[model samples]
Target chain A: MSDNISSSRLTDIDGWGRSESLRSIARRSFQFFYDNYFRVEWEGLEKIPDDGGALLVSNHAGAIPMDAPIIMHGVEQHLGRPVYGLADHFFRQIPVVGTMWSRLGGVPAHPDNAYRLLRDEHQLALVFPEGTKGTSKVFTQRYRLRRFGRGGFVEIAMKAGVPVIPIAVVGSEETMPILFKINSLAKATGLPYFPITANWLMFGPILGTAISLPAKFKLRVLDPVHFNVPPDQDRYSKSRIMDESESIRLTIQENLYDMLAHRGNPWLG
Target chain B: MGRRVLLTGLGTFWGGKVAQSLEKHPDVDVIVGMDVTEPIVELERTEYVRADETYSILSRIVDATQVDTIVHTFLVVDSTQMKTKRLHEINVIGTMNLLAAAGCAGTPVRRVVVKSSGMVYGCTGRDPLWFLEETPRTDPPETTIEDSLVSAEGYLRDFAQDNPHVSVTLLRFSNVLGNDISTPFTETLSRGIAPSIFGFDPQLQFIDEDDVVSAIEFATSANVPGIYNVAGDGLIPWSEVAKICGASNLPLPPFGTEAAASILRKMGLVKFPPEILQLLRFGRGIDNSRFKDLGFSYKYSSLGAVERFAKTKRLSKAIGIPRSPYTYDKDVESFFHHSPSVVRSTQSDSTSDTF
Candidate 1:
C-alpha cells in the first residue's frame, strides 16, 4: 500500500503487454480511419454479448488487412470493451511495430493466448482463422474465403468454453487489393507471401504500403456458434470441429455476398 | 532425532543464505555444507567441507553423514559466470550425482529440494502469455544453460518417480533482482544504460533475492511435492524495468540483435548471453498460483522487487559494498565447531526473524 509500490512503474503497460495510454494514442489515429476513411457500418453489434468472453471470427483481406482495426475500433467505441485482435506471431517478429502492436492489444495468435484472454480474462477476442492465406488473395479472388487453419480456432473456443461469433465484413478486399503476389520474393524474404497491391502502384514505394483506400465497410455479426458441449476438454472431436469450422466459413461467405450485393457503390454506403 | 541437512553450493549466494537461515531453525540438528570454495558469509553452526564442483565424492559424504534432507542450491543458472563445459558439469552432472547419492538403495535423505530457474521454459514467439505449472515449453532449449536445466529437471522427474518415499520439491525461480546477487539483469541495470532489442519491449517477471531464499526455505521445510514456480506477482515490460532502475534503453538493432549484443559484450559494455538475448526479444512468465496454494507467500511483487533493487543500487553507488566484512579462517572455524574444551551456548538467536 506504499506509494512506491506501483509508483515506480513508468508506463501503464499490463501483464499482457498492452498499455492503455498507448492504446488511446493508437486509438486516436485508428478513430480517424474508422470514421472518415473507411466509414465502416455494423449490423447486429448487440449479438456480441455485453459480458463474458466471445470469439470473433471474420473474413480477412486487404494488403494490410484494415478489417482488424475497423472491427476492433467499432467494438471498443460502441461497447466500451477492449477487443484483443489475434494475428500471426509474425507481427511480433518486426521491431517497433511488434511492440506498438502488442501495446495496442495485438496479441500473437497462439491458441493458449486466445484461451487465456477469452476464458480466464473474459474479454472479446478477434481472430481471422484464414490467417495469411486469406490476406494472400489477389483482387480477382476477392470475397472468396480460405480454409480456416485446420479448425484450430474452433478447438480453442471449445476448450475455452466460449461462443464463436462469426463476423462477415464487406469492402476490406478493396482497401488495398493485391494485384498479384511474388512467391519467389516471399520465399527469399522468409515471409509467408509477398503481394503487390494496387495502392503500391498508385502511391509509390512509401505511402503505398501504408495507406488503405477509401472503401465503404459493412460488417455483419452473425449468431454466436455455441458448441454447448462442456469446456476445458483435453480433446474435442476433430470431425465435429472441422464441421463447425466449415459451417462458420460458409455462413460468413454467404453474408459477404449478401452485404456486397446491397451496396450500390464500393466507396459509398 | 531432529532433521539432519546437507546443503550443496555453500559458497554460492543461495546456498550460503539458506544455510545461514537454517542454522537458526530449532528442528535442524546438523548442517553440513559442501562447495568448491570457502563460504563468503560468516556462519555460526554450518560446518563447511570442500568438494569438487561436480561433487565427485557426494555419495560417500551422504553415506557417512546420514543427512535426512538434501538441499541442492548450487546449480548455476547464470551463463556468463563460467565456461559452457563448467556450467554443464555443475548443472547436469552435479545434479545427477547428487540425486544418485540421495536416492541410492538405502539412503537417509527423506526430502530433496532443488533450486531451478524459470529459464527452463524457454522464451519463444509461440509461448503463451502465462505458462501454467503443467505447460510444456513452446520450443526446445536453445542455449546451453537452458539445455542443462531442462536435462537436470528431467533427471529430477525420474528421481521423483523412482523414490516415492522421498519428497522432491523443484522451485523454478523467475529472474531475481535484489541486493548482493549478481545476474546478467542485475549487471545490466547497475550500468548507466540498459540495452534493449530495438522496438521490442518484452514483459519480464522477477523474484526478489530475499524472496528467493524464503521460497527455497518454504519448499525445504514443507512436504510440498512436485514442481512449483516462485516469482513475484505480475510482469512488467523491460522498458519499465529500465525506467525503474533509472537506466535508459539503448536500443540494439532488432534485426541483427544477436550480432549487436555480441559486439557490445566484446566491448565489455553488456553481458547479454544468447538466453538473455532471446529473453529480451520475448519474455517468459510462469503461473505461481500452485506454489501459493501450498500456503507460501512472496514478500515483494515484481514492481516491489524492481523498486527495491533500484534503491539498493543507489545506496551501493553512494558507498560501495563493504570490502570483505567477513573472511573464512579454516583454523578458527574448525576449532570452534569441533573443540570440546570451548564452551558452547544454545543458539536461540533473538534476531532470527530479521533474516
Candidate 2:
C-alpha cells in the first residue's frame, strides 16, 4: 500500500481491539516474561495458516489464567499477526483488568464479539473452553482435562467457517498447583475458588502463594480440523457441533497425557 | 406531485433553515411555518404563523393549508436554553400535540418527517459498537431528553401503525455539530477543560449541520417511510476528538465525575446530565447505511464535522490553542526528530542518521 493510503487507513481505525501503539507496548512488556521467566518452547509453529481466520482451543490453567496470554504472545511472535483471546464475561466486570484486557485485544466472549473477530475481521481467536473448572483444579486433578462448556467454540467456528486448531500446553497446570479449594472463602471474596497452594501457604500474605512457580512451558499446536462444509451451511446441527467440540476436547486431552508421559520433569521442559 | 409543506419549530436554526430551503424548492408550492417564536432568519415567500403546540391553531393550519407534508423539526437538544421540565414539555408534549393534530381524521397531512435523536440508543456499558436502524429503542431512556425522544418515537410508531395512509419517516440523527448550531455536545467539546471518565475513551459519531438539513430535505421529498439512523461516515474516539479540538482532558474517576459535573453545571459550562457522563464514558455510534441506501449521503464524516464546528470563532475561545496543521502521528514523528539527542546526532553527522 502507498504511504498516504496506509496512513489514512491507520487514522480510520477506531481504536477497538489491537490498538497498534498500545499493543506494541504491551507486547514488549509481556515478551520479557515469556522469554526470561517461563522460557516457553513452542512446537508446531508452522501449523498456523499465514492468512485468514483460525481458532485456537487450549486447556485453561493457572489460578490467574496466564495460558491465554502465553499462547497469544507465542503466536504473535511466530506468525507476525496478533491473536485476540476470548475472555470470560467475568473479566469484563472487573475494574482495571477488564479495561486493560480490552485494550490488549482481549474481547469478551460474547457471540457478537466472537463473530465480529472471527468472520468480520478474519483474525485468529483463542478460546479456553475448560474455563475456571480447568484452572481451579486441585493438585491430584492436575493435567486431567475438565468438561468443555456446551461447545460454544464449535458452534462459533462452524458459523464462521474457520478451522479449529487444538493447542496443548503442559506447564501451566504446575504454575499455581492448588492443594484444595475453599468454597466458603471463595464465596466471600467473589472468586470462583480460594485455592490453598504450597507456595501460597508457605510464603505469607502480600507475596504469598500468588507467585507462580517458574515451570518451563511446552506448548504443542495440533493439526487444524476443517469442517469442509459450506460457510453458510446449517447442516452442522447443534448435536453435531457438540460432538465435534467433544472430539476436539478429547484431542487436547490425549495430547496433554502424551506430553506428560514423555516429559521427564514438569519444572524442566 | 408537488408538496404543500407545514414546517414546525420555525424559530430554531434547523426549522428556519429547512423552511427557507423549502420556500425556494420548485416542487414545494406553499410553506407554512409554525412556532411560538418568530423565525430568526429572513424569508420572502414562507408564511410564519405564531401558535403554541397545545393550541388548536396547528390543526386549523393543517386543515386550512391542506399541507401534504408536515416536517416536525421541533426536538429540543440543548437544556441550557430552558428548564429541563419545560424542555420536556416542548419535546414530548409538543410532539404529542402536533401528532394528534396532524393524524386527526380528515387532516390533509399525508406524510410526516420528524427529527428524532440518536440519543434514544442510550450510551451504556452494554451498548453494541454500532446501533442499526432496526436496533430496539432503549427502554426507559438513560436521560430525560432520551425519555422524551423515546416517547415521541413510541407515539410515531403508533401513529404510523394507526394511519396507514400517512408516511411517517423517523430520522434518528446522531449528535449534530455545525457552525451555527450550539448543542450540549458542542458546548462540552468547546469547554476549557473537557472532562472525561478516566481510562474510558468511548467511540462517538456525529452528523454535519448541513447534512442534517439535506437529510430532512431528502425525507420530505422522497417516498422513504421508516426509522433510519442518520450519521456521518466514520467514528472517532472521544480522546482523539479532544485532541483534534485542541482541548485538554481533565480525567475524573467514574464516582468522582458527579462532583465535577456539579461544578460544570454551576459554572454554566455544560448541562452535565447523567446521559452526558455516560456518553463521555461510553460514547454512541450508529450505522447509517440505511439512510445512504435511501439516496442521501453525508457531506462530512464525524471527525470532519467536529473539525469544522471547532473552527468557528465562538468555539475558538475554549480552544485556546489552534489545532496543528499536521496529523497527530506526524507531530509525534517530528517530536522525536527535534529532541535534543536526535537533534545533536543529526546536526553533527547528517549522512547516516535514522532517528
Candidate 3:
C-alpha cells in the first residue's frame, strides 16, 4: 500500500497558507459563491473561538450533503480558520472527487480514524454524529435530530479531552426536498438509504438534469462545551467509555435541535 | 478614660477585623462587640452580645449597655436575604432603635460612623465621570435583593440632619479587601480564581481593611457630619487584576443585562446584603477630599492588595506561578501541538465514511 493510503496518516492541505494574494483569492471565490449561487446567512459566529481545536457536531440534512460544506464555508469565512470535514469511504473511491476530498482535509469516518486524527492532530474535526440516519431521514421527520448511535465522536472527544461545539445548519433540506425512501433499492445498492426527493424523479427523467433550488443557508456555531473526563478513566472498560460518549453525544444533539427550533427561519430578516 | 464604643455585626469577616483592631486601640475604653454569634474573644472590655441587629434587640442592647457612641459597621453580604423587609429590619429600623435608645438614656452620643459602599454610585449607563459626595442617587432597574443600598444612604443623610446632638458620618467605601477571615478575596486570588467580571472594561477601586478601620477611627474623633469616599489611591482594570492574580480573564460577551445576570447565576458569587447591588453597579466614587482634609491616611490604597497580601502569606502554591492551569490538560496541550495533522485525518475519515 502507498504511504498516502496509510490508515493513520493525514495529508496536509494548503488552506491555512499565508500567501496574502492566495488568501484574498480564496476569500473572493467564497464571496462570489455566497452572493450569486447561494445567499449564506450565519448566526452565533461569535461563539466559535478565533483559534482553538474544537469538535463541531451538526445534525445532517440534505441527502446531497450541502449542510457540511455550508457550515465549513461559514465558519472559515467568519473565524478565518479552515474547517476540515470527516468524510465517509465512498468519496475516496471516485477518481477526481477523491483527490479534491484529500486536499480539503477529509478524513475517514471510522471511530479509530477519528481517535487517531483528534489525538495526533489538534485541528477542528467536523462530524455529523447522527450518522447516515440523520442525512437519510425522510422529509416527514424534518428538523428532528435522529438517534445519534452511542456517539463515537463523544467517546473520541472524551478520550481526547477537547471541547465539543454543537452547530446547526438550516435551509439545506429545503434546497432538495426528499419525497420518500426506497428501502429495497437502498439495501440492494449497499447504501445507507435512498432518498426519493421532488428533484430525484422529475429532474433525471423529465428534465434530463439534476437541479437543486437556491435556498438561503444559515449556520450557527454554539458555545464550546468542554468535557471534564476523569484521568483514571483511561484504564476503564469499553462499556464505560461508550456510556460516557453517548451521554455527551445526546447532550450536543439535544442542544442543536433546540437551537434550530429557536432560530425559526434562516432566510427571514 | 477610653471611650466606650459599640461595634455591631462584629461576627462578619470585616466586622471581626474591625473588632480585633478596636481591641488593640489603647484609648478604646471598651469594644462592646455585638453579634448574633457566641463570643469567642475574652478581652477585658471586648464583649460580644448575642442579639440580632433589629429594631427591638438593638434598642434593648443600647439601653442595657448605656452605649452612647455607636460604630455602625454591621453589613450583610448574603444576597438572598437582602429583601426590603430584611434591609429595613437591619439597616433602617436597627439604626433607628440604636438612635432612640441613645436619646432616651441621655448617653451623650457625640458621633455615629456608618460604613457604606461606593457602589451607591450606580456605575452603569452613565458616562465615565468621577463621583463626588454630592452625586444624586439614581435608582437602577432590576438588581439583586441587596439593591436597597441606594435608599439606605438617603436614610443616613436624613437621620444625620434630624439629630442635632448626634453627628452621623457616612464613609462610602469602594470594594473592601484585606485579610478577611470569612470572605477573603485574598484566598480566592491565591487560588488563581476571580469572581467572574461581567464586562470587558471593569474599572474598580478597593479600600484595605486597615484603611477602613482607620477611616472609622478618623470619623469618630473628627467632628465631621457628611459623606466621604473612603477608597484606595489608585484604580486597576479587571484584566490586569486577573493577570496579577494568575487567573484566566474570561470576557463575558455583551448580552446586555441578561448576560450579566447569567454570569452571576452561573458563578454563584452574587452575595451582598440587601440593597447593595443597585449601589454596587450604579454608584460611583465617593469623594474623599473632605476626609483627607481631616488628616486621614491609608496603608494600602490599590486593588494590587491581592498580590501584596499573597506574597505576605506565601501562597505561591495555591496560585500556579510561571505555569498556567491550561497546561494541566494533556489533550489540550496535544491539540495545540498537532492541530494541523489532526484536522486532516478527521476530515479524511469523515469523507471515507460517506462511501
Candidate 4:
C-alpha cells in the first residue's frame, strides 16, 4: 500500500520531534533509579507496532497517576515512536503542567478529538475503560475491575478498524496500599475518591511524596486482537466484535490478577 | 430489696438507649427514668423523675429515689449553640456541677459515667496512633470544638482525681450515630445535595448508640476509670458512607479556614458551626480495641448505625420538613431566601479571603 501521510507529518502528529528539553527531563526522571532502585520488567513490548494506529487498553492503579508515565516511557523506548494519551478535562485546567501535557501530545478524551486522533492523525490512542472509578477503588476492591461501562473503547477501536492491545501493570497497587477511604474528605474535595494510604497526611510535606515504596512495576502488553469488518458492512455491525473484545479484556484482567497473586518480589526479576 | 438505679438522661437520646440496655441486668431492681422531659409510658421503669439535669434540681431526685448508681448522661451537644460561655457552662461547668452533686449526694452514689467525644484529638500536629486513656491534650488550634472537649476532659480528669470515691469512667467516643438526635454531619448529608467533604481523605470512626449505651453500662458496672475509646467494630471511608447513604451526588467544596468561616456564617438550625467544621475537616480515626479486649461487643457497628438511625421517626420528620425549592444551581437564591444577603456575602468574603 502507498504511504498515506508523509514521515514529517507522522513525526509531528506523534510528537516525536518535540522539544529536546522535555524529552531530556522525562528521560532523566525515569532514569533516576533505572539501574539502582526500580528494575522495570516489560513482558509484551513486541505487541506494539513501531509506527501505526492502535489502541492500548490498561488496568489502572496508583494514587498519583504513576502508571501513565511508566507506560509512556516504555512505549517511547520500545516502539521508537511517541504515544498519544487521552486525559481527563481537569488536567488541562492546570497551569504549567497543562501546557507540558499538550506539547507532549496529551489530547483530552472528548469523543470527537479521540476519533480525529485515530482516523486523521493516525496516532496510537491509550484509553482506560474503567476510568477514575477503577483507579480510586479501595484496597478491598482492588484488581476486581468495575463494570467496563458498556465497552465504549471496543466500539471506538472497531469503528477505526484498529487492533486492540490490552496492557496490564502489576505492582502499582503495592506502591500505595489503600488503608481505607475517607468519604467525607473525598466528597468535600470534588475528587472521585481519595485513598487513605498509610502516612498519606503526616508524610506529605515532610517527604513531598504522594505515594510510598517504589514497588517493582511489571508491564505485560498482550498480543493485539484485530477486528476484520467487510468494507461494505456498516459500523452498526460492530456489536459482533464486542464478544471478542470482552474476551480479551477478561483474559487480560485474569492474567494480571494471577500475576499479582503469585508475584512475590516487588523488585521484578 | 435492691434499690432502683436512677439513670438521668435516660429519657433523652443517648441516655434513653443506655437506660433500656441497663434494664436487662438481673442485678438491677428498677431503672428510674429522669430527664428534662417525661419518660415514654411504655418503658417499664420503677419510677420516672421529670427533672432537669442541673445540679440543684437533680440533687433532690437523687435524694428522693435512693439511687445508688447515678449515671449522669445529660449534656447538650448542639454545636450551633456552643458559644465560648455556653461551651464552658454546659460541657465544662455543667459536667463539673453534676460531678460535684453526685459527690455530695445523700444516697450512696457509686459510679458516674460521662460521655466525652473523640474530637478532643484536634486536627493538627499530632501522632496517629491509638489514643490511650492517658493521652495528654496537646495544644490544639483555637478554632476547633476539640479545644472545648480538651477543656471538658481536663475538668473531668481533675474532678475524678479529687473525688476518688466517685468512680468516674469517661468514654471518649467518636461520632455517635443513632435515631434520637440529628448529627450535623448526617443531617447535612440528608439535604440530598452533594455534601462538601474536606481535603479528600480523613479517617472516620463512628459508634452506634447501642454500643454507646453498652459502653456506658460496662463503665457503670465494671467501674472502669480513665478514658476509653468507644467506636464501632469496622471502619469505612466517608465517600463510601455517603454513596451508601445516597448522598454522594452533592458536591463538597474544599474545606479550609474559608469553609469554616462560611459554615459559621451559615450557623442556622441546620448548618454546622465553625468549631464543628474544623473538627470535621481534620478529625482522625479512634481505636476502640481496648473496649473490645474488655469483652464488649457493639450491637450496631459501622455505618449500619446510620441506617438504624435513619429508620427512626425523628429522622423522617426532619427529612420531611421541606427544604426550599431552589436547586443547587440557584445557590444565590437559596442563600438569599434562607439567610440575609449581608451575612451570605460576609461568609463568601471570609471563605475567599481566608483560603
Candidate 5:
C-alpha cells in the first residue's frame, strides 16, 4: 500500500519537533516579557558563536524557570539561529505544556538529543547543568548554584566536540521565589517538589502559580570552555569530566555573584 | 550455488510480502516459507510449509531445506489481535525454537533478520527525543506485548553472543503506516473521529510498509551485523498526522483515559491498546541513521507515509476499493510447482506482489 508521494510536507516542524511558525509566534508574544515585564538585559552576547554547535550552560532559577525561553528568544532574535532548549523530562509529563514546549523547541535533556543536536546537526543547544536542583531551590538558596548532575552535561559537550559557553543569569531567582515546599503534596502528585511560591501568596492561587514576579533580568555570557581531549570516544576519563563540570559550575556561580553585586535593586535593574 | 532463504509466517501479510519480494531476486534459488495457515498471496516459485503457530517443525525444516538466510517476520507485535498467552507463545517460544534450530551444531543458517517493533522501547514521557539502538527504555516494559518482545530480543542477543559466526541483525521499526496495513493509528484515523488524549499532541514517527519489506530484504542480503533502528526521517505531531489523514480528533479526557478507552473499545469503534494509548500520549521516534548509514534510503518520510495512506484511503472511500483480497489455492500452486505441462518464463509475473 506504500506508494511514493513527492513533496508532502504540510508543516514547518523539524525532526526535533520544533516548528518555525510556532516559534516565531511564541517569540513575538514573549517579546513583551523580554522588553517590559522583566526588561531583560544582555552582556557578552557575541560569545555565542554565529554558527556551528555549542552548548549554552546557564544557572537555572525561578519556580517556572523562565531563563530557558528568555535565552532561546534572545539568541534567535539577535543571532538568527534557532536554539534547542534542553530541559527536564518532567515537563513532558504534562499534556498541553509538553506539546507546546516541544513545538517551541523544548527537548528532553537526554544525552542522545544533545549529541545529535550538537555533533550531528551542528546547531546551537542550551542546557541547564543543575537540572531540577537549580530551579527547585528555596529563596534562601537564591544565587547559590546547586550541584551539577554528576557532570553529565560536561561529558556530553566533550563527546559532541563542542565548546561549553557558560551564561550567568540574575533576577530569575526572585521572579517566583520558593518560600517553602510541601513534601507530602509533592509525593502525592508525583512531582519532584511542590513549593508554596511567593507569587502564589502575593497574587492568589491562579495568578501566583502561573505568573512570575517582574524582576529585572540581567545575563552575562562567559568564555566558551573547550576540552583538549579528542571527541567521539567510547569512554572518557571520569575524573576529567568531573573537573571540567565543576570548573564550569564555579565559573557560572562566580559570574552570577558578580552580576548580582553590580545590581542595586532586584526589580529595578 | 544461488542463495536459499527460509521465511517465517507465510500466511501473514508481512510473510507473504517478504516472500514475493524475495522471489524477484535472480540470485535467490530457493524460497521456503512456513506459517500456520496457507499463504495469503499467490507465489510462482516459493514453496510454503504449514507449521503450528510456535513453529514446532522448524528444526526439521531447517535441516532439510538447508537455507542460508532466515527471515523471522512472524512476531505478533499487535496485542489487540490475540491473547497474552498466545502472543507470548508466538513471540517468545516461537523465537526460542527458531533460534535453537538456527544455532544447532553445524547449522546451515549464517544470517538471521528479526523484524521487531519500536514498542520494545516502551513509550514514556521520560524517553529521549530519538532513541538510539543501544539506548535503554526509561522504564521497563509494562504491557504484555512489550514484555514478550523484550524477552525475545534478549534471546536473540544471547544467541548472537553464543553463535558469533552467525550475523544477527535486529531491526526495531517505529510505527508503520501503509495503504493496506491497518494498524491502531490507521484504524483510529479511518473512524469518524480519531481518539486522542486531550491537550496532548505527541510527536510520532512512521515508516511505509515498503520500507519495512526492503529493510528485511536488505538485512538478509547485506553483511552489516548487530542491531539497528529503522524509521522514516523526522517526526510529525499526532495532530499533523490526523490533518494529513483528513480526520478530526475526538479528544479523550486526560484523566480517566483508560476508562474512556474501554468504553470506546466496547463500542467497537477503535482499538486503543496499552501501547497505542501510551503512544497517543507520548509518541515515539527511533534513530534511523544507523540503518541509513549503511546506504538504506527510505522512499517516504513520516509525512509522506501518512500522505500516501490518506490518498489511498480517500480513493477507496470514493470508489469502493476494487481489491478482491487474494486467497491461496493449493491445487493451482502445486500444479505450478510440479506440473510438466506448465511453462517457465524468464521474466517475472506482474500479477504477484501487487498488494
Candidate 6:
C-alpha cells in the first residue's frame, strides 16, 4: 500500500523468472510470521539502488531457511520492488519445495542465473555466500561466519558491475538450533545434512522445531560497496575476488558481533 | 527474355498462393504449376502440369518448360493432414527428385528457392539461445518426419555442390501462424483449453502467413544463395501467447501429457503428432539477420504476427473470445523489450555470456 506504483500498474508481477502471483501468495502466508511472530525490524533500506541491479549478500542460518523469505519480504516491503533469492542447487532438486521456491523467485545458484538476474534483468538479487555450511552450523557455533564459497558471489558482482549490499540477519540461528548433524542418513533423503535439534527429538516434530521459535529478527542492511572489474577478466583469479569476498565476510561478521553484543539474551533480540 | 518459373507443390495451399502471385508478375513469361493432384484453386496466367515430383517426370517437365527459376514449396509442415507414408514420399523422395532434375545437363534451372521450416534446428536443452545460420544441424533425426527433412536438405546441399550452375537458397522458417494456415500450432491456439508442459515456458518465434508469402516471392525474384534462417523480429514466451489467445492453460506433467495426448488424439481432441511434444516442451528459436542481409525486410514482428493471427481468428469467429484486442502483459513486454539474447550477443564477446 505504501508503494508509489498503483495496483493497476502492478498487474501480474511475473518477470523472466519471478512469478508475481505465487510470490505474493507465499509472501502473504509468510508475512503472518514475519510481522506477528518474529516481529522483524528492517533497517538501512535506502542504501538499495532505486533503479538498476544490485546484490544483497546475507548470512544464512536456521536449518529450515526462514531467513531467506524474511529478507525477501523485508526488501519487498521497503523497496517496493521484487528481490530474487539465489538458492543452493540442492534446493531445486527437492520435490514440491523446489517448485514453490522457483515460483517465489528463488533462482538456482548457478553463475548463469546470477549473471542474468543482476546484469541482464537489472533486478535486486539476494545471495548467501555461506551456503549450506552456514545453515547447518550447530548451536555452539551460532553467529560464526563460514568460509564464503570460492568468492563466486564477488566474481558475479564484479562481472555485473553492481554494488553489493551486506546484510546481517539476527535470530535466524536460534529459530531451530541444531545440536547434532547426521550426514550418513542425509544422502538417503537428498538433504545436505540431517540436523538433530533439541526441539525436534524432545518435542514433537510438528509442534516443535518444525515451527520456528518466536525469536525476534533484526535485519541490518549495511552500506553498499561498488566494485569496478573488467567484464572480460578471468573470474577464477583468487587474489582479486577472494580479497573482496573476505572483506564482505568480515563486514557481516563484525555487524553480527555488534548486534549480538547489544542484545541482552539469545532468546530476545 | 523474361523469367519462366516452375513452382512445385501447387496442390498445397501455399504453392497455389505462390503460383497466383507469380501469375500476376509481368516479368514472369511462363508460370508452370506442377503437382500430382489437382489444385483447389485455379490461377489465370499459370499452366498446371499433372506429374509426380519424381526424377524422371520432373526432368521431363524441366526439358519441356525450359524454366530458368524453380521455387520448391513442397515441404509438408503438418504430416497429419495427409497419410503418413504419402507425406514421407512427398517430402523426402520429392526433394530428391527436384535435386536430380535441377542437376541434369542443360536443365536451365539457374536459381532454386526451397521452403523449409525452423524445426531443422531441433529444440533441445543444449540448443544455443539463437541458432545462427552456421550452427551445425545437430538435431539427430528423432522421428520419421525429422529424418525426411534432414535427408531432403542433405540432398539439396549435395545437388548444389555437384551442380555449380544452380544457386540453391533454403529459407528455414519458424512456425507459421495465421488464421488461414491450419498448422498444429494454430490448432493448439484455437482450442478453448490449450495443454502445455507443466512449469516450463519456452520462448517461441513465429512468421505471419503474409510474410511467408512475401519471403518466398522475394527469394524467387532474387538470387540469394546459401541457407538463411527466416524468422520475424522479437520472441514471445508460449505462456504469453496462450494468454493473448484467451485459452485457459492446462498445465500437464510431461509424463502424463504424452499419455493424455495419445488418448486425446483418439478422441479427436488433439491433432499434433507425438514427435511435436518435444518442440512443445523446448521451443526452437532462430536468428533472422541472414534473411535481412538478402535485401528483404519483414513487416510483421513475431509479436505483430501473433496479434494479427489472434485478430484474424477473432474476426473469423474460430477461437474463443480474447480478453481484449491482444496486447501483451506489461511485465512480459518489459522483460523482452530489449531481448537479452539479442543484446547479449551484441554486448559481450565472451563465452560466459548468459542469454
lDDT value, residue B193 of candidate 1: 77
For model 4 chain B, the run of ten residues with the poorest summed lDDT: B346-355
Question: What digit string (tens of lDDT, one per residue) describes model 1 on residues B1-355?
Answer: 7789999999998899999888778788899999998998888788999999888899999999999999999989999999999999999999999998899989998999999999998888888877887889978898999999999999999999999999999989999998789899998889867888888889899989999999988888889989999999999998888888899888888787888889889999987798988889988888899999999988998888999998878878888877558788999999988899877666565226533
lDDT of 2 by residue, B88-108 (tens): 888888888888988898988
Find the 10 residues in a row with the least total lDDT in model 6 chain A: A1-10
Over B1-355, each residue of candidate 5 has an lDDT whose tens digit, in order, gives: 8788999988888998889888888778889999889987778789999889887788899999999889999998888888999999999999999999999998999999999999898898877778889889889898899999999999999999999999999999988887777677777787646778998888889999999999998988888898999999888888888887888888888889989888988998658797888898888889899999999899988877888888888888988887557778888899988899988755445334443
Global lDDT of each candidate: 0.90, 0.78, 0.59, 0.61, 0.88, 0.77
Interface RMSD of each: 1.6, 4.4, 25.9, 21.4, 1.4, 7.1
Residue-by-residue lDDT tens digits, candidate 4, B101-130: 666735477667777777676543232323
Better of 3 and 5 by TM-score: 5
Pairwise TM-score winner, candidates 2 and 5? 5
Model 6 per-residue lDDT tens digits across residues B92-203? 8899888788778877889999998877777655454467777765558676777777778889899889988788899899888887678887887787556677756656
| Model 1 Cα shift for residue A145 (angstroms) | 1.3
Which of the CAPRI classes, incorrect, acceptable, medium or high, describes model 3?
A: incorrect
Best by lDDT: 1
Count clashes in each candidate, considering only residues at least 3 apart in sequence or on different chains. 0, 1, 48, 14, 0, 0
List the candidate 2 regions with Cα displacement exceeding 4 Å: A1-13, A89-98, A130-151, A178-211, A225-237, B54-56, B78-81, B137-140, B313-355
Which candidate tops TM-score? 1
Where is model 5 chain A poorest over a 10-residue stretch in terms of lDDT?
A: A1-10
Tens digits of lDDT, candidate 5, A1-269: 44556546778888877899999999999998799998999999999999999999999998888898889999999999999999888877787888788889988888888999999999999999888899899999999999988888888888899999999999889999999999999999999889999999999889898888999989998999999778899888999999999999999999988888889889998
lDDT score for residue B54 of model 2: 52
Residue B116 lDDT (model 6): 88
Writing each residue's lDDT as its tens digit, candidate 3 over B1-355 gives 6577888776655566566566555566666777765433323235666676663666666656665578878754334544657765676566666556555545556678888776566554331224567765444634432354555566666666767778888888776665433343444454555543243333356676678887877787667887788887655544455565565543333334445645554676433322332222222344466678878877765544544554434444545344212212335534643477644323223223221
Clashing pairs in 6: none
Residue B314, model 3: Cα distance from true site in angstroms: 5.5
